[model samples]
Target: MKKQITSVSLGQNAKMAAALYVVISLPIVLVLAAILAISGQAGQALVVLVATPVVYAGVAALGTLIGGWLYNVVAARVGGFEFTTAEVKAG
Candidate 1:
């Protein structure tokens, strides 16, 4: 059997996922910024710390939107995805 996806909440899903990615990446960004500063690249460090989150979030949002759109279009034609399930007994 084939199933179809009729709609996708592209914008909402994209933004929420982007926000989560930004939040999760904050510590890594901070650490990279600190490394740059310690390496005597304070200006670069400042820019990295200030801009990384914003840029990362924007890219994530845009990428997700594009991906969602593509998926919707392709799924509509290809009938979404296929999967099967079987019951498993736990020991």
Candidate 2:
């Protein structure tokens, strides 16, 4: 079967992107914070720990929203992404 992605739900896409950004950033943020804390910049480390994910998530959400909106516009003019799929039989 073939299908086309005509448009995206901007709100839902942005929300999911934000969540994924936070999840992806957690490990890197934790390590950076840990290094800063070990270096005696505890306050900065604390701020980094609390703020990095939030900032990254916000940026990701905004970017996703803009990208989705652009995609919608372009899709309307040029047609949407097309792909094929097939059902698999039981093994």
* Model 2 TM-score relative to the real fold: 0.95
Clashes by residue pair, model 1: none
- For candidate 2, lDDT tens digit of each residue in 11-72? 99999999999999999999999999999999999999899999999999999999999999
- CA-only RMSD, every prediction: 3.2, 0.9
Q: After superposition, how far is residue 74 of candidate 1 from its true place, in Å?
A: 1.4
Q: Candidate 1: deviation at residue 22, Å? A: 0.6
Off by over 4 Å in 2: none
Model 1 segments beyond 4 Å from truth? 1-5, 82-91
lDDT of 1 by residue, 1-91 (tens): 4444556789997999789879977998999999999999999998998789888888889999998899889877776656555678999
